[model samples]
Target: MPLKELAERRAILHRKSDPQTIVKHALDDVQLGKVAMVSSFGAESVVLLHMISQTAPDTPILFIDTEMLFPETLQYQKDVAEELGLTNVQVVKPSREKLLEQDVDGILHTIDPDACCALRKTQPLEDALEGYDAWITGRKRYQSGSRAELPVYEKSGRKIKINPLADWNAAKLVAYIEEHNLPKHPLVARGFQSLGCAPCTTKTKPGEDPRAGRWRGQDKSECGIHIVDGKVVRQRNAA
Candidate 1:
């Protein structure tokens, strides 16, 4: 279950079939009641969530509630879950002791965003994902820097990571949302192209990169939840 072996296993799976095939295979092969989906409830998350809800409504949907997130995000999460009729939308949160120990100053995001993300997102997710054999994600290829090369299926230790939207683009996402009359995050229309924690996100201007607002002014971009190889590489830092 080492990182290297996991990557090797993921590579082998990727070579065997395309992304769509991988998703179908995972859905069919993974044991019932043992799978879950991790959703950010961001700009384009509804597409995959809808797909999963239709394909497997009973599957548990895990949403991380980092206390630093915008209030609008929390509302949107509820709306989306209700609209989609998601049966099991469990909200995972970081433990108070862990947050107090790591973010006692409440300014860790400004001084050390990586560590803050590790505490709020990575560690909490690692804990939430325990006992699951496979999980679904909403990653797409045309999203940003590193995500442009995302694979459909990956191996994370002993668990299977499935990206059902790996081949989707921004235009397709928007189109699907509109066609379905899905509710969007309020910040999306206000120029916040990419939404994350309140302080880490900003509104972008025309011609500016969609993710430019994330960790603005700083070299930091991703929150380290999605890693590559054995190291934690941010989405913006890659490629």
Candidate 2:
């Protein structure tokens, strides 16, 4: 099936459904039998992860560990998986040899963030997802920038990208987390609204976009993972 048609058909089928229902439909895809969920396991990650744990506990969950990530994030990833009984958590990382060659000093993020992300995140994820035909993500439209127009379903290459939470907002996220008593990323209470690699993420101030804390001073918003169809779409920085 074509990616566009697949996304459209699924979107129509789940038009009136909730985010969890959208997730369930993606998990049940016959053509894309081996779907994976890519999660950051950051501040707002628990919602989708918790949904996946109930909908498909065995589904592979990809967690890209940029060597630059916060220690809290690493521990949060482990704790979340254990707490949810997620059995197929796959840890993806840039190869040691490549890191030694391209970013030996670990300062690539300072000179070229795009290269840094491609080296640590994009390429590693692309390599890890070689055999999968579809993947689920935790993006929401309210996150801003190009994501402000995010769709519930979209096709990327031969795979269908499902954004089950595309319509959710901060209020919904907060309510869901509190209602479920989900654990938060340790940095949230410390004023870090968005959690990414420690070196890139910073503290968000009052009335700022939730993601303002990510890549604080840079012109970048995303870490190069949220490509739109075939084009590399850069998100807006600073709400």
Candidate 3:
């Protein structure tokens, strides 16, 4: 389908529909063709994951392990999946050959963060999403500047990216988690409101944006996973 039509469909989907309804529509619609849920298992992630679990327990949940993530995140991924009974949780990782060729020492993030994220995140996720026509995300408008206008469905490359929580805010997320008794990522307690690979992630300061810690002191906001108008909008920080 053309991008314009997809936008129209997104408008219809967003009209009077809640987060769980969007998730259910994506998973149950055969036209979507092999849907998967991509999650970082970060703070506020369990809300969407829990929605997916309740909607469809066996939905494919792709968790990218950049291999540089915090040990806490790694354990949290396992714990959340088991706790939610998410049977098809797939642990995706950067390619061994690609890592050897590009970031053998795993310090590429220190030199060029965008290139590092492309290698460790974008490319690996592209590979993992090869056969899928649609994928779900836990992204919200409150996350970052780039995602401030996030839609319920977006056209990314050849796939339809679904953001069920696009309209959600921090308060709603907390309430949902509290009501569901969902597990939170361990690092959130340490001030890491937005979790990513350990090397680029730091604890956010009080009154700062939740994503302030990611790629701190850098002009980067997103990790290159978010594509807009068929282009990667990785560095959205303007001088």
Pick the TM-score winner. Answer: 2
125-197: candidate 3 lDDT, tens digit per residue? 9899997988999888887777777788878877888888888989999999999999988788888889999
Candidate 2, superposed: residue stretches over 4 Å from native: none
Instruction: Give the per-residue Cα lDDT of candidate 3 at 166.
Output: 88
Residue 113 accuracy (lDDT) in model 1 = 87
Compared with the true structure, what per-residue lDDT tens digits does model 2 show for residues 1-239? 77798788887777778999888878987865689999999989999999999898999999999988999999999999999999999999999999999999999999999999999999899999898988999999887666877778888866789999998999999999999999999888999888888888889888888888887777788887878765677756845
Inter-residue clash pairs, candidate 3: none
lDDT of 1 by residue, 1-239 (tens): 65345545655665656444655556776342267889989877778778777777767888999899999899999998888889889899988998888897678888888888888888898889897877888887775676777776666555667786788777888888898888888888888877889988888877676677888877777787776543676545332
lDDT per prediction?
0.76, 0.88, 0.86
Error of 2 at 102 (Å): 0.6
For model 2, what is the C-alpha lDDT against the true structure?
Answer: 0.88
Higher-TM-score candidate among 1 and 3? 3
Displacement of residue 52 (Cα, Å) in model 3 is: 0.7
Global lDDT for candidate 1? 0.76
Maximum-lDDT candidate: 2
